[model samples]
Target: MSRVSDTEPCGTETAVRSTRPKDLTSRSSFGVLGTLYSAGEQGLALDAHRSLSRSTLLRLRDRRTGAFIEEFTAWADGFGEYRVRLTARARRHYAHHHACYRELYPDIDTPVPRPTDGAHGGLVDHRADRDPARNLLREADVLVLDALIRLQGGEIGRLQKPPIGRYQRGTSPEIGAMPPGLLYREAEKLANSRKPISRLLQHPDGPLVAVVEVTSLLPWAATGSIPLPALIVLTTRGRDHYESHLDSYRRAYPDLDLQLSRHTM
Candidate 1:
């Protein structure tokens, strides 16, 4: 056997690489699984399904939709069928629900709850991110997945609300009420306060991210910011309020990729 060659560049030498056996002891798998679960949590999770069961979902949807229907029953005279189908969930959530928002519920402003200390110290707690986090994410995933499925020729699930487009003219005075100019104004107000668009220093090396109001882009689009970041919108009210805007807002910002979550509201 002809043997050694000193002229071989050190870079070209191939040594026996450490090959860890794949099994339960693999640390890498846990990390990957954690990431997958985190990603999966971005939509509604199973526990949420139990908490916000089909009955509860219908109640919330119908309550909200019914309120809208009542307000615009006359103007939306011909669209009764549409409203009935859409606002089913809203009706449930708002039905006899007398809890006023801290802001609007009581005439006096209510103090915001302080964030709690944790092992991560001010880092957003995954659990606090939502109640029954897994369930919420699963539900959201189902919502989007259903939409895509319908686009792929599957039957569309009956949406609790008839989308923004189907809202009766009477119920949605805010829609046509905003002229192009006002869209800019409202969007700017939201941008300035709840939806400020800026890069956080913590993520300087990554893709630019901004937490903006779902309505901010309405103005940006009007002002010719043709493209905007995909936003995660929040509301002070509750999850129900936030979910109401998800589809329309997602369609608004197709780029600046990310999932839209209901953080505050």
Candidate 2:
């Protein structure tokens, strides 16, 4: 990992960011599955397909040519051929949908949520570090897993998003970071506060891929001024699972802090 000045946002070490184009062109349609993301609102145990089907306005593409046969009619103007109906979901993905973010639905310009921040570094969660409680860790795991699927768009089966309420205050001293939320009021209201999982990208019919966070690198609260830790990730499928296709995830998500887990298989 390269050294980033500790002054700006703290997630760029492995953050997933969008290099938004000045204007949309035909080539913009190339990103199909990864064009969207979502924070699992229903948990990775529900049928998300049913929710996606509700959207009347949809976008389709030519498989061979990778062109947008159906373009966005609403939501965003130049986000490629991504469907317009569930644009709120896509927005959620970019709007601090990762972890420990309290910001709600945010626009495309909103800054990516960070696990740790400037000099204080205390603005982070050590839950995944000091205390790996089964319940809380599992919840975090489910969220990370669903996020992986949303950003990676593999054959993972429909996962119901976990409710945000599941977030509990951890006894771990290091586990004192911000909560997940959105920046804008309108976008926050539109987010899945009522619904589960804000955004999704999947086949109309596909088998759920059983996966979740097996291990993850939680930036520890500053240990007497030590800087934030480099973002790391490990999943149920092991490290190679992501190592092989990491670039794809980065394309959709810029500050994505994932490495790969060496367990689950």
Give me the overall lDDT of model 2: 0.26
Q: Write the per-residue lDDT of candidate 1 for residues 1-265, one digit (tens) a residue.
A: 1111234332332212232211111122222222222323132322322222332223222331121111112123454321111122222222111121221223322233233222112112212332333322223222332232232232322211235332222344443333212122332332333222222112233322223432443443434334433333222222333345445433322111223442322
For model 1, the stretches where C-alpha displacement exceeds 4 angstroms are 1-86, 96-130, 134-142, 150-153, 156-265
Q: Rate the local accuracy (lDDT) of all candidates.
A: 0.26, 0.26
Best by TM-score: 2
Worst 10 residues of 2 by lDDT: 194-203
How large is the C-alpha RMSD of every model relative to the true structure?
26.6, 22.6
lDDT of 2 by residue, 1-265 (tens): 1111224332212222242221111122212212323332221111223332211112222222122123332223654222322133333333322332221112222234334321111113222222333212122223343344343433221111122122212343322222121222222232223121221112122211221221121233333243332221223342333444444443333223433332322
